[model samples]
Target: MKKTIPFSLLALLLYLAAACSTPKQRVPEQTASYTPASQELYDTIARMDSVMFDAFNKQDPDKLKEVFSEDLEFYHDKGGVTDYAQTMENFRTLFERNRDTGLRRDLVKGSLEVYPIVGFGAVEICLHRFCHQENGQDDCGTFKNIMLWQQKDGKWKVTRVISYDH
Candidate 1:
């Protein structure tokens, strides 16, 4: 006895066969929107920034030990790249050298932008001015900075830093 396939099954098989024969095009990656972060996240990052920079302003590299990750990557425009150890050492030397002169960093008003990184912590983009005593006058320079903060075990630390536009 001869058996015949059902019309619906045949049509579906043909459609699938045609679909399989066609070349597939890859979809472009979709980037997240640049929306403002939640107020809670913004506040948390702001506080963290304060903590980290406060240590810098105080010339206390020890305080930064908890703020930066052990495998931190810091990229500076003029100074190039520095790992965690070198970065910390540089900070120590800078702090020691400028201890008496005093260097202060102030965040430019309305220039702070915080964005979440999904599973990671957040990205902080801001303009800060560093001021120091030069020739008995305040010498300040404003620069752009991008910091990648990572959150783990209920603690936040900066994992990468991109400081440029000096």
Candidate 2:
């Protein structure tokens, strides 16, 4: 009887030891890599550029205002650092001066650069302007835009924009 009890106790200890020693299913460490093929991420960045450019071409101050964050800051070529309200006001003034002012975005290029948790993009934009009131003169200028974007809650949002003429 004593021998049997000892054997049982040893078996129980062995079982517990084995159970605790069993290696857990090793989970692969999450690596931080920018996979460009991710359709959702690509679309998010593309949409941000599209909306921004569309607002510019249409001269829709309201839409443009909505695209930018409340605390957005813009550094323009001619204009220095502009706050959100100031930028909107500038656009409004421009639109008001020339009701027929039309903008054509040409040769716009964009690229995405990713970091561990954040990313940014550099965009080259060619601005073409046509206004009948201004003698129908066509104006052309090239600008380099550096925009910082962040992924928040699976959505990409532009936080800052800095542009300078080349």
Candidate 3:
């Protein structure tokens, strides 16, 4: 007596056999990414940026401290990756050096741009000009930076800085 095999079962077996016999092709890794803009988020980051940079130039460590996450990864193009302590130390040195100089970093007019990183947080791209009024000399220069602000536990803190373009 001959046994009958169901059509669905036979088709599935044939498909599996064919699939198993074929060589698998490698899939290329995705290299494209997109981030959208958030105005409310921009307002928040703008406020945060003001809090951090203004206080920074004023040498207000307490106020400056409030804006950055403890695990900050500040990467200055020239200074390399600096952690919290190193950044504070650099700030201290900078503050000490420019105590009476009126050293300030001002965002270039209309250069501020913000992009949301979905759940991570946001990214700010801007050009800034650093000016110093020391003695009888007032000097200034422009630069650009990309900053990453992260959100954790409902609070947003600056986590990274790709500072460059002096």
For residue 39, model 3's alpha carbon misses the true position, in angstroms, by 1.4
lDDT tens string, model 3, 26-72? Answer: 22222444233677987888888887888988888777777888888
Judge candidate 1 against the unseen true structure and give its global Cα lDDT, from 0 to 1. 0.87
Estimate every model's Cα lDDT from 0 to 1: 0.87, 0.59, 0.80
Using alpha carbons, what is the TM-score of model 3?
0.74
- Against the true structure, whose lDDT is highest? 1
Q: What is the clash count for each candidate, in the order shown?
A: 0, 0, 0
Cα lDDT for residue 4, model 1? 98
Query: What's the candidate order when arranged by decreasing lDDT?
Result: 1, 3, 2
Candidate 3, residue 25: the lDDT equals: 29
Q: Which stretches of candidate 1 lie over 4 Å from their true place?
A: 1-35
- TM-score, prediction 2: 0.58
Best by TM-score: 1
Clashing pairs in 1: none
